[model samples]
Target: MAETSLEQIRSRVDADWNRIVELLKSKIALRSVSAEGITGDHMKRSAQFVADELRKVGVDAKVVQSANPDGTPGAWEVIGSRIVAPGAPTVLLYAHHDVQPVPDPTAWNTDPFVGTEIDGRLYGRGSADDGGGIAIHSGALAALGDELNVNVKVFIEGEEEMGSPSFIPFIEAHRDEFKSDVIIVADSGNWSADIPSLTTSLRGNTCVDVHVKVLDHPVHSGQYGGPILDANTIAAMLISSLYDANGDLAVPGIESQEPVGGLQRDLDESTVRADAGVIDSYTLAGTGSLAARMWTKPSLTVIGFDAHPVEGSFNVISPETTFRLSLRTAPGQRPEQAQEALAGFLESHAPFGAQVRVDRLENGMGWAMDPNAVATKDALEAMREAFGIEPINKGEGGSIPFIPELQRLFPDAQVLVTGPEDPKANAHSPNESISLSGLRHNVETEALLLAKLGR
Candidate 1:
């Protein structure tokens, strides 16, 4: 908050940027994919790698394997801490070490596990989604070195990509370890590589697998095509029922309205189109500003399907089909409420008396931060000082399920969600990346925030 009295921290981050990049590359080299059955020993090794890295910077770090709901020892989580004084306010830093499963590694321009620096961007699977987050905290801490003042605690969970299945139990078992005056979730993105942003709200999320059954067995298309609709066609009809002609959600109980708050910043249409990779001539859906459409409004997407492939010639009509829907909720709406409304609408809209069932329901709550919170002010000042530009405020369309839980667990702590990602990061997709300058500024911003809090 003071006039760049912490300029030394920024200089230090700049000096150590290359070393920080190397650390991040080492992290990206580990394939810690934690998606369901694909999880393996790489997760444990990744956690240990992060722990060892933290310890090297003078933080006390260790690895813990928490159990899932089924009572099996689950993924690894890294917990690290450093104490300056008993009187200093404690700050908890959060990031995930696990990455999403690479659907097709061959689709990447380089190896998904290798961090590639091209045109000033570091590209890799985990390079941005969270690997940059760990680098941000580590870079700041290393720069501060003997100047560090506040007590610091770090939680790097390995199951975030799998919706953090065991995070709640893990937190419940180690609650005291995370008690702090401030919490920084470094898992969100900036407005752009040039403009820094603070995520003021995050959309909640729900997912379900729907089964549409039209017949007991597959039938010949030539014989049954006249009167009966195949399960695939019927399933499409049911999904289309969820949206109106304008592409807004049509469910009755699900709320969809323009936001009246949250500093919904202006986003250029061309930038949105380019960032989302929307094809030319394809109009954007929903109403209101692009920011609100993404962050405050509800959206439904068919994430996966179980239909037949076109490779083999099929003269038969499929009798049954299953699809997965990922629904994002508005700020105030609960994931359960949205899932219920969606389920009801789907069952009622079953085409031609087809049997419809919604199964495998999963949900995570959303969150909104006060624009005038003290910690937000501190962070904004930190960003301004680091980037030398007025930072923008935005909300995340994606869900970090564990953030709301951390809020519920520590009601008094100020939670600041900021990170090194930008619109071009393309996290969770192939070719994910973070700009080198953005990463460096983020490290400076974090260091300034810590220094301000210490003061």
Candidate 2:
């Protein structure tokens, strides 16, 4: 497509391979975990690190800061640009510098903050999620150098792991800077290690914390348990009502979309069981095709419950119970619609006239890309050529709010989602890691995509 040959690009990536790993390791060691008790300093440093790296690839980069959703504080957003092809379409590469927090450090085999390489996998928090993402983008740019076919704009967000509460505002402030004909989100995963994938759909997300109070004060369970309804029991009933006998979402009026891309009807149960660490005794929930259930249909999960701990041995039948419900909406379902439907279901299904308070926490819209769109077509061809295999068009169950937001902001731009994460990556879990070979292939794919699209 350009003067650079595929072999030359591959050699460049191979030669500077250690540098890419080192950069990712440095990022992982920075402790840029999503703002738990940590301040914005680490994320700021991480953004600066990305900016500096981009600058090394013949681009000028800068760090931008803003507020979080609560207006307390937010992470940094690193941006940079290089105009290799003067009049060619500008391609925006997106990756996040932030990462999910390690729930328990003791559970990890290695220090989650330190990037450790073992068995060709880089282990650490953020190493795969977006740190590997940052490396992929930078590695691609390094391969192209100043001869890139398209004008390049790199955006490494700092609050992705925190659900990107400040993302829309950041985009609003930098409207012109984010302008582009194509936007590639380097934050999703491939189908497998050797098999590449193009994420064509992402599930939307909506959640609420439901608190049910049965009595104003605690009552002796031994004396009055049978006569009064316990908040815990009512909460359990409400949660059970969320699904029908077949384990499908029982919420009325919730929307769902048919599966796209001729993807497989059902996901391999054996693969899921192995990857998810499901026990042999555990039964798979939900009805219908697994892929449809995962990527194109609504699913409800009771993430947490707050009640008197059994360890305390408090026989209190009275008081309150709270539970958090995480809902994954189908690709075409509107966020507002899903939220309204869920809220209505909970409000109407309060057990035995119990007081039910459903507090909506967050809702993000899902996105779907036209598989036959010009940009999507170009990406498929590039991936096939780069990976030497026909790429699989897949749908992801997770939500990336920025996808829909970016689509709204850049109506004409083609937004492509690709990354190095495989199902075995175990992102957000203890012992998270990335495949070195997969990372290299992803880098090759992006570099080739840029060249092909520009040409």
- Which one is best on TM-score? 2
lDDT for residue 135 in candidate 2, whole number 0-100:
92
Candidate 1 local lDDT, 1-455, one digit each (tens): 24235678867877887889998999999888887342468888999999998998878999999889788888899998999899998999999999888999888888888899999999998999899999999998898887788899999989888877888888888988999999999999788888888888888989999999998999999988969899999999998888889888889888764543545467799988887788999998877777788887888899999988989869888899999999988877888998898888888889899999988588999888766778889999989988888988888888888898999999999989998799888888889988999999899889889888888
Candidates in order: C-alpha RMSD to true structure: 2.1, 1.7
User: Which residue runs of candidate 1 sit more than 4 Å off their true CA positions?
Assistant: 1-4, 36-39, 257-260
**What TM-score, over all chains together, does every model reach?**
0.95, 0.96
lDDT of each: 0.87, 0.85
* lDDT for position 196 in model 1: 87
